[model samples]
Target: MTPITEVEGRRLPLSNLDKVLYPATGTTKGELLHYYAITAGVLLPHLHLRPVSFLRYPDGPDGQLFFTKNPPPGTPDWVMTAPVPRSDDPSARQVVIQDLPSLMWAANLVVEFHTPQWRSDAPAVADRLVFDLDPGSPATVVECCRVALRLRERLAEDGLVAYVKTSGAKGLHLLVPLVPTPSEEVSAYARRLAVEAEAELPSLVVHRMAKKLRPGKVFVDHSQNAAAKTTATPYTLRARRTPAVSTPVTWEEVEACTDPGQLVFLLEDVAPRVGMYGDLLAPLFDTRGAGSLP
Candidate 1:
């Protein structure tokens, strides 16, 4: 095992290097070593023994994270993201995770929280429902963005404040945070939104449960919005060679991205650390008047 080094502000102890392995993917090559090295450095302080995980983004380096052996059951995926230059004109070097074991070790030390303010102990005040929309055709990423904005407006009108974040892949996720309610009600709310989507973009969107039924169109995935269900938290680090994270984006840039695969942010590019559950998703922590993290 190698000693951990400090970068930015975190100190990483690289004492473990026997448990991690990298899967081969064209997204990045032979760079898993570097990724693990960095992941261990970034996530070591937050690890735990439970099967914890979150999506990673590719911003500064290739996308990947040193975490979970495999994601927990019911985890949402393809939420991975990577940051890319408007142009790779200089053909910069791809970042890498050099030590797998340490990265994997560090991964275990961190506790991952998705489904914001999700708790089995404390009373949940919000039910997080997300509509992660992906295009069915090659028409354009903007076309999908147009639909996302329309969807966000529609959700907002219903009293559920909608926040938009990049899947860090190609799609945009419309998040609706509500007072913590049961799954059945959450599912129903999702169903209503799905219906609304179909009504608003009859030609572009479909709510059919059967994937085969909705050909060449965007489908509203109400399934993820179910009670106790979760969507990848925006800016989560995923365990892939090229670390990808979910990103919050301005609606204008949403339409400009071409490939759904290209719009993610890397761990290096994400804001450092989180304050409890993080403020972007602060409503989940509101507990209304419940007072501090319980």
Candidate 2:
């Protein structure tokens, strides 16, 4: 493992990643960091950056291993390294979010910034939504990507947007950021939306939740559409074998693939290929004031 990167008063553990390769596309924790720094560098011109969380694991004899979503501050130019963890090995895992404040220092691009037009006074439609998809299953991920993309398009057409992030463990999250609407109402609206979506895309997707019913398709799981329900934050470094950073991507990317191979990425990777930033899906939270429905 590598030594800690010294900051103002505290020394932050930076690298000595404890991850196994993902085969042909397998990447080292170090490579992941590089990917992030490169990506963050691209966004230095836009977006408001935030703190990072770090997921650490020990690399057996190698000592502590780690990865990150947000790396600790003063990361020594961003080398991928993690504090050693306690376990055999995680096929995948959560690393960390660090040096949060510094993320703003690196902001440069925007994906869907509309702060100028945002109006909080508008009636709160459905705020705070979570779309829980499956992660362990590649088929589920693709199925989910399809459902989410369709939702994004529909929402966009309706003048609403949704902020998307991965579930980090098994699925993707399509968070419709509303201005704090009641949870039940939001959940109700979500159910309605799900019904409509399922009706429209019955051949490719389904909203049914019973395991016996899911077969091989994705479930919208509108159950997550309830209030007081918070989805895992995007790019949150989690605990696991290989640390998968939750990220937001383009609608096209979501539509083209369902492979976990294409799903997760380092926090650094989110902004680069994007060449922009902003919660494109932020508008979905605004509700139409329709009371909760059965």
Candidate 3:
């Protein structure tokens, strides 16, 4: 067992450093923590002011896993938590990630994935709209690129700028930074875009959420735009077989991606990619809406 360490003024009691999460890659818990530590600079900005939901793998990735909204018991008081009101009970408090130390604390819990809401606390406003492209089997990521390109064109017609990334699984995520829009307005706008996409490419894209109907097509899930709804934060590790990361990529790469593997980044790739792209999603954090069209 490795001893607990301090990071960003927070004490993290980390253990089981050698526990393997990705069976195929043999990626260990310590490696995961180190990855987060090294990439914290780029990753923290996206996580800042957002409530984070965790996908925990206690034993390992292949072992029993659970999703958690509240911080687990024994969470240090130093880990900043947001008192987000729950949907079922507006009075119920849901803890969200506040800073780098809090995020590192989550890494100690073996949080394999970090999913954050679209809005931040300082403004409690939605700064971006997300379009989640969930593809059913036989559709593949190649199909997602085709669909995303079409959606990008549609958004451009409305004078909106768009960016994209692999979901780090079987899909893709498209984001459009907005000028502090209401949650409902963002949701409505995303829904409208999804509908337009489906109407334009009936065979390639579908806006319906039903899994039964999504086969051979990309399901444009605009619902993630709603308050409290989350999409995996960029650079978050996916609890997949090979340690795939939710990575940001350029539209040119999306179009050039022949297979999803080309975009499936891992722990080692984080630094280089961050250096190359320099926080590709930074526009989402710019409240001035510099890139958004007037």
lDDT of each: 0.48, 0.48, 0.80
Per-residue lDDT of candidate 1, residues 42-87 (tens digit)? 3332221112233332222233433332334432232121221123
lDDT of 2: 0.48
Candidate with the greatest TM-score versus the true structure: 3
Which sections of candidate 3 miss by over 4 Å? Answer: 113-124, 290-294
Error of 3 at 148 (Å): 0.8
lDDT-superior candidate, 2 or 3: 3
Residue 287 error for model 1, in Å? 5.5
Q: Which has the greatest lDDT?
A: 3
Please provide TM-scores, in order, for all candidate models, with all chains considered together.
0.57, 0.53, 0.93
Q: 98-180 in candidate 2: lDDT tens per residue?
A: 34223322211101111101122222234345666652232567777877888877766655556566666566777655555
**Cα error of candidate 2 at position 64, Å:** 15
Which has the better TM-score: candidate 1, or candidate 2? 1
> What is the C-alpha lDDT profile of model 3 across 23-130, one tens digit per residue?
898899889989998888888877777777788877776888898877688887777776777657665444466677787888888775555445446334677878
Better of 1 and 3 by TM-score: 3
The candidate 3 region of ten consecutive residues with least summed lDDT is 115-124
